[model samples]
Target: MRARLLDATLELLVERGFAGTSTTLVSERAGVSRGAQLHHFPTKNALVVAAVEHLTERRGAELSAAFEELGAEPVATAADRRTRLRAVVEMLGDHFASPVFTAALELWVAARTDEALLAAVAPLEQRVGRETHRLTVAALGADESRPGVRELVQATLDLVRGLALASTITDDSARRRRILREWADVLDRELGKELTA
Candidate 1:
């Protein structure tokens, strides 16, 4: 029941944004009573925060699996590392374009003015950001210890997220793919230079 409500909340958040997603809609979609949802979440902010956190955790685990898969592959040389870095960029682009990211984006927008929601989301957002950077650095075999390397990796995430936002409203999949590919090549050159230096 809890899981169903969370799932319904994420679906509503992605489809409706923060303004459109209501407890009534969530209850109806989840096939649960409004009373039941209130019992579980208590408030709209609570529900939205919980839902975003749920999606983030689920997506984060999938990302971890992707990083593990990268490790299991035979990356024996600098050339192989460059190839893997490109794959990681591709994977990050896919993740940013997912519904989970859309849902989280909704929360982030709403959190700007809503102090309660901001308080609820800030720590979770920090943790998510940290884990994402850590996993990306690991998967790319990038030297985070190097000056500017971590910031460059973080810049990669920001770039993909902006692309994801653009793709959400436009018929830009082909263009988005092109941009990601080009950016991957750029990351490989810049980051690889730093890591090997």
Candidate 2:
């Protein structure tokens, strides 16, 4: 029943914005009796909190798995850089259609007014950043824990965020591709000497 309510809330959260998603709707969509939902969540806020946790757990695993898979690929040496680079770029690029990011945007908006949701998401965000740092270091074979990698990682992340926000309203994949191409340029410039020809 708890699982049903959370799954329903996630679906509604994607369709309706945070304020628009309601406990009643969740129960209806879940086909869980109202009594069962109330027994689990007790309030709309509690249900939303569960939704936040649901997204956080799912997305954290998704990202970690993606990066882990990227690292796990065969890249015997620096001569293999282009292959590894393209694979990493494509992996990050796949986030453009990611339902997880869409759900996260909804969770981000809900967190603005919901302290519990914010609290639940904050640590997850930190863990994600750290995990990203580790993956960058592994991919670049540099101490990306240092300041230089911070700039590169944060810049790339910000570009992705800007594009993700735009992606919600702007239904143009060409525009999205253009935005990422520009980002690839920035990365190229920043990594010029280090790209190892």
Candidate 3:
């Protein structure tokens, strides 16, 4: 029941943004009664904030699962390393372009003007950002203790996020693919230099 409400809230958030989504709408979408929805989440802010947190956890798990499925074979050659790195970059880009990101963006936009929502969202965003950075480092098999590697990983995340934002305005698929590919090459070279130095 709670899961259903949260899922519906996420769908509505992506479809209608925070201002348009209401508890009534969420109840109807979830096929759960208003009473039940209220019983679980007493306010719209509670419902939406919980939904974001739930979606973030789910998305993070999905990313970890996807990364695991990418195979753990040793990179025996430079070509193999490049291929693996490119796959990671592509995966990260796809993640940022997903509906979860769209839904989160809606909350972020709304939170900018709503002090209460901002209070709720700020810590959540920090936690999500840190988790994402950690996951990216793990996915890339990066040692952040090395100089410049941490900043490079952060830049990769920022790049993907910016690409995701651009995609919200229009079909940025072709350009995104090109940019990700170029960025992947840059990562490979930079990380390779760090590894060998």
Candidate 4:
């Protein structure tokens, strides 16, 4: 029952921002009683937090799968690393094109001012960084202790968020592509290697 409520809340949240979605909509979407929704989440903020977590889980799975695909490839050189990174960037770009990002951003913006939400979503952000770093290290056999590795990781995540924001207004593929390429190039240079292309 709780899962259904959260999933429905997530969908509605993406479709409608925090202020636009309500308990009635959630109950209607989930085909549950208002009392049931209340039992699970006494306030809309609680539901929004749960929805954020659900979206985090979904994106985490997508990112994990992309990393798995990268690992399935044999990357032997800097050029190989660039190829994998670009593939990853493209996959991440596609995933963020969904409506979920808008809601996530809305929640993040709200979290900046709301201590409760900040408490809820902080772990999700940490998990994303840790998971991305682990996957990159595993796939490339690169020790994360290498200099600039943390910067590369941060660049990757920032670009992911930037891609979502850009896609909201312009629908420009060029921005995502260019940033991803540049970040990959920077990482490659830091690694003291050259790309084939």
Candidate 5:
């Protein structure tokens, strides 16, 4: 029942924006009584924050699973390593382009104006930033000991976020793919053996 409410809240928050996602709407969509909704979440802020956290945790688990699955297969050659690195970039780009990201964007935008919301979301956002960097480092075999490698990974994330935003405005898939491919090639050339490790 709580899961249903959180899921419904997530959908409504993404579709309606923060101002439009009312408690009543969430309860109605969840097919639960208003009393039940209040019983679980005493306030709208609580509900929205819980929903955002739930989605973030879910996405984080997905990323961890992908990493584990890839870890099971060893890279046989430099060519294979390059391929795997590129695949990681593509996977990260796809994650940024997902509905989870869109919903998180909505929350972020709303939080910009609401101090209470900002307070609630800032820590979650920081944790996500740290987790993403750690995962990217592991996925691409990035050598943080190298001067520019960490920054390059961060740049790649920023680039993908821009691409994801563009996708929200138009069908930017083809262009996004092109940019991702071009950037991947650039990283391969610049990072050299570090990326292939």
Candidate 6:
């Protein structure tokens, strides 16, 4: 029942943004009764926030699973490291371009003017951002302690996020792929240099 409501909320958020999403609509979409919806989430803020958090958790788990599938074998050569790096970049790009990102973007836009939503979203964004950084670093086997390595990792995230944002307006898949491919090459060289140095 809770899952249904949260799923409906995420769909509505992506399709209609925060303003178009309401508790009543969510109940109807979820095929849940008004009383039941209210029982679980008393307010629109509560519902939307919970839905976003649920989606983020689910997406994070999926990404983590995908990362695990990349294998635990130690990188034996620079070419091997580059291959893993490219795979991680592609994964991050796909993640940022997913429905979860679109739904979260809607909340971020709405939260800018809505103080109550901002209060809830600000902390949530912080946690999500931190976790994403951590995951990306781990996925790439990046050592942040090296000079400029941390900033490079952060820049990779920012780049993918910008690509994702550009995709919101139209089909930017071709261009996004090109950019990611090029950026992955740059990261391979730069990170390789840093590691060897």
Task: Tell me the lDDT of candidate 1.
Answer: 0.85
lDDT of 3 by residue, 83-111 (tens): 98999999989888988899889989989
lDDT of each: 0.85, 0.70, 0.89, 0.74, 0.84, 0.88
Candidate 3 Cα errors over 4 Å, as ranges: none
User: Which tens-of-lDDT digit does each residue in 68-173 have in candidate 6?
Assistant: 7776668889989888888889888988998889988998998899898788788878888898899888888888989888998999999989999998899898
Decoy 1 TM-score against native: 0.92
Candidate 1: worst-modelled 10 consecutive residues by lDDT: 66-75
The TM-score-based order of candidates, best leading, equals 3, 6, 5, 1, 2, 4
Model 4 per-residue lDDT tens digits across residues 1-197: 88899888877767776667899999999999999899989998888888878878876787777677656666776677677666766666666666766767777777888999999888896786687667655654455576666666666667777778888777777877777777766666665442221
lDDT of candidate 3 at residue 68, scale 0 to 100 = 84
Model 2: weakest 10-residue lDDT segment is 188-197
Model 2 per-residue lDDT tens digits across residues 22-136: 8899999999888998999999888877777787677767767887777666556544654555555556656634767777788888777778888986777677667666665
lDDT of 1 by residue, 84-181 (tens): 87788888888888888888888899999999888877888899889998888777777878888888889998998898998778767788888888
Reference-based TM-score of each model:
0.92, 0.82, 0.94, 0.81, 0.92, 0.94
Candidate 3 lDDT at 26 equals 99
Once superposed on the true structure, which residue ranges of model 1 sit more than 4 Å away at CA? none
9 Cα displacement, candidate 1 (Å) = 0.4
Question: In angstroms, how far off is 135's CA in candidate 6?
Answer: 1.3
The global Cα lDDT (0 to 1) of model 3 is 0.89
- What residue pairs are clashing in model 4? none
User: What is the Å distance of residue 106 in model 5 from its true position?
Assistant: 0.4
Query: Higher TM-score: candidate 1 or 3?
Result: 3
Q: Could you tell me the TM-score of candidate 4?
A: 0.81
Residue-wise lDDT of candidate 5 within 31-67, one digit each (tens)? 9999999999989999988987897797788778767
lDDT of 4 at 152: 65
Q: Comparing 1 and 4 by lDDT, which wins? A: 1
